[model samples]
Target: MDAETLPPHVVRTAPGQYEATLPGGTLRMSMRQEELPLPEICDFALRHNARRRFLFVSRVLGRHMPTRPAAMQDVASRLADKISIDPADGPVLFVGMAETATTLAQTVYAAWCRRGGQGLYIESTRRPTGGPIAFEFVESHSHAMAHLVHLPSPEDDPENLFTTARRVVVVDDEATTGRTALGLVASYAAWRGIAPESLRRELAVLARWMTDAQSTESEFTAFHSLVEGSFEFVETGVFAEAPPAVPHPDRAGLARRGTRHGLSHPQPLPWQLDVSPGHRILVIGTGEYGYQPLLLAADLEARGAIAWVQATTRSPVLPGGAIGHVRSFPALSGERHTEFLYNVPEDHGYDRVLLCCEDVLPPLEHPIHHISRLEVLPLPGTLTS
Candidate 1:
């Protein structure tokens, strides 16, 4: 993830302040740019949480942006190629940070499996499953601080995916201070009664922007990423706060659908979307219910459409960095929280942008408000999550 001479992507906006030129617009921010090209991978945004004045928003993570499914697969495959484990290596478990990195982690785990690596994908969630709790950790900066790690037990791990596990690989979008990842591994190590020095552990991310998050001279701990470097964020303490974020979905429908509890494969709803084949299609998942959208994308691809799945997020970011564009509209969750999609093309972004939601159809004027060539296609059935 280290580069020799990447061009600077951040520009000084004002005295002691900077702006990242994202794909969409100039994101006003202040960062002491380090050796890394800050805007190439991500940009800064104001956070609703007062403790953390800014947020390192990613372009390709698809949380605040709409990204192609194949592109995500490409990233996962490329990352899989980088992670190597000898057959003699112990069982591995990949932990994807919930809400943000769940899908990304699953994508990498899927690729890892294709590469003949043995691993189970478990993610930390704010939602409680009422099942066995493996361990827990804290992300102090996140709006949702509490995290639950649900591990598979003897009955679920017939293959000994848990018992034989000696390695832990944590995946995330970006590493700001690296404390979260380090803390997670430390907690897991304590739970297993093993010293952190006893096992192989690595923190993987798309961008290594945090200086503290960078790799140091240690074999016991390592950091890997698609792009690695550092940026300086000089929070002016004058940024506007985003509106309150809706808490993680906990509706009975979403819980039954396993929105929070980790899923090897999201249970598919027996429903379908009708669209033309062979076209480059964009399917938008409303809110955090993205698994269903991915399933829909796979089905569309199988039906001859070059399909990709992306979603609107409750998280608000000042546009820029990989965020070429941002589409702001009311969400279909019936919560009235603002929804956003980043870097979607203007005219030719895609042949069609299908707004997919579980239940509570968006208003008739919603889709046309932000996107053209849009169709409000309801994913059949009373869906929630």
Candidate 2:
């Protein structure tokens, strides 16, 4: 039976204590909300990280679980609608957190632009561009702690982007402590020599504070989310530190793709996808090179194909709860560490699977090769590896 079909049940992993029977381990999860149902958007999982034992795997994030690009787009559009920053206030700057939120940030930026709000867009990156760094921040609890914000190209921001922006919107999949967003604003504010109070802060997230501890939204000038919730995970056993998915991409081999540096606006790439109605397609992004593939999937979905977006990752999680399937593939950049792709079930009859990457890849050793037809597509602006 699929994990999703399994009822929320608990097991006693310790004496006189019970925990929710999730994928990685036991977790007792609860949620509080106003309008949108939490389960529809997210589910619980146990993480290999000790700093945060529980993980809120988003069903629509196009990360852990494969989701239709249309679904991802809708979530982003709704979140973008909640952002009401006026361009006249000063140029608005939208920042997507590294890794997971890259695509989300792009979508929200595009959606906001559609609403006639002009803004500069950028996403933090774990893989640095050899260019000058704008600033740095940390996601303290994350498996990969360091994140770098790079300088915007001259065309994207003719003037100083950070100093000129009156409002800044940080987009993330979820916000628990909200420290990451707060730290981001702090870093940018300090680096640009502007008072933190002088710049308005905003966050666009799927849910805020997944635990009942306390709301961290107060740190920001405005908080926008589809739902508000809290959860509790009583860990009954210890899991080893999950291995990193793949070794870091070579800095010298870094390929400029998506909005890692900055984009004048969120524009669809020139590439076109041939899609047909009733055809199910899966678009897979190589680690960190996710946003462009999602754009491709979204475009294919618009043209009558059933397209789902998901990416390979370095963060590790056990197979249970929200994560039902796991496949390890060698890094395309020839990194030795094992990279993983999650949640493509065995019986999923996808007509084709597109593995989007920053550089052209040779034949990769992955379990999915036999399950479906696989193709590699280079992300636009990619440098040859």
Candidate 3:
């Protein structure tokens, strides 16, 4: 099979089972929404795990796939529009899930603010911050189970967003069991010594499972997603066990700034490089530092440069299915695991590739520059005071 070939669309493999082929195995997805645009918004990929086998590779997430910054912004803005927060209820708080939803949360948060919504934004992170802790919880099915939320700096939230917030919105790319979001809501309520019912809570996601009424929260928290659906995966072949989770890397000399600690309507870092009109450009983000790269790319697109954005991720996935191409690079942060950048096919024909980083800038002679084939330039991320 050609690596660049997309997976077959949903096909009836049994009486009521519709299956799609993946590099690891076959998956069955049964959706609830009318003519759910699964194929349009996402495609299927395979991940080896006892808990889950299929990965919903989002086409516009700029995580596993290279996507236009405008497309990503439109999808995020639409999701933001769905989130309704009453002003009289008090200040709102937005929590972007770690790793994957970090950029999406920030994009949506920015859109919400542009519409005149007042709030503070923070993202859950796996990195260690030896500062005051806000709350911590677990995503049981995740390869990395534990997640930490850092307490917002008083400078970022002078009005006390967390203490006074009456509405809390947890954003993620997708929700399966919805346990992670609920767990976060519970943890937040407990940390603040407030009843869960007292706060207006919502889960904002691009897609989610709604099987057997699983879409609805058991508590007072509301749910919102672009698509509501259920999926069942029956493995059709034997596969390797998922590799051990990556250990936290040492951030000793890295500049300490970003959403993990807190940022209210984060400003986009300037990209000093000059780009001309009609030149195809791709801005690649490094690990969790995805949102800023996206902001930079969006700015480039606005300035008439042909630009798209994606990120290097630690996720393990097969090369076929939704993933057309994969490039492995040694961990820049000195972590043991290999990092991957996917879906940049040989024919992508981009004039330039900008690899944006927050920690340390690599020399121009790095292997990634050669491996990617395009002119790879290292760009700095957000600036800190």
Query: In model 3, how large is the Cα lDDT of residue 203?
Result: 87
Q: What TM-score does structure 2 among the candidates reach?
A: 0.87
Score candidate 3 by lDDT: 0.75
Measured by TM-score, the strongest candidate is 3
* Candidate 3, superposed: residue stretches over 4 Å from native: 1-18, 34-36, 212-216, 246-255, 345-348, 363-366, 373-385
Cα displacement (Å) at residue 236, model 2: 2.4
Q: Sort by lDDT, best first: what order?
A: 3, 2, 1
- Tell me which residue pairs clash in candidate 2: 23-320, 23-321, 211-231, 245-314
State every prediction's TM-score relative to the real structure: 0.71, 0.87, 0.88
Cα lDDT tens digits, model 3, 115-142, are 8888999888766556777888888766
Estimate the Cα RMSD of every predicted model relative to the unseen true structure.
6.2, 4.4, 3.9
Give the residue spans of candidate 2 off by over 4 A: 1-20, 23-26, 210-216, 241-252, 335-337, 345-347, 360-371, 380-385
Lowest lDDT 10-mer window, candidate 2?
10-19
Backbone clashes, each candidate: 10, 4, 0
User: Residue 262: error of model 2 in Å?
Assistant: 0.6
lDDT of 2 at 99: 79
- Top candidate when judged by lDDT against the true structure: 3
Give the alpha-carbon lDDT of every model: 0.63, 0.74, 0.75
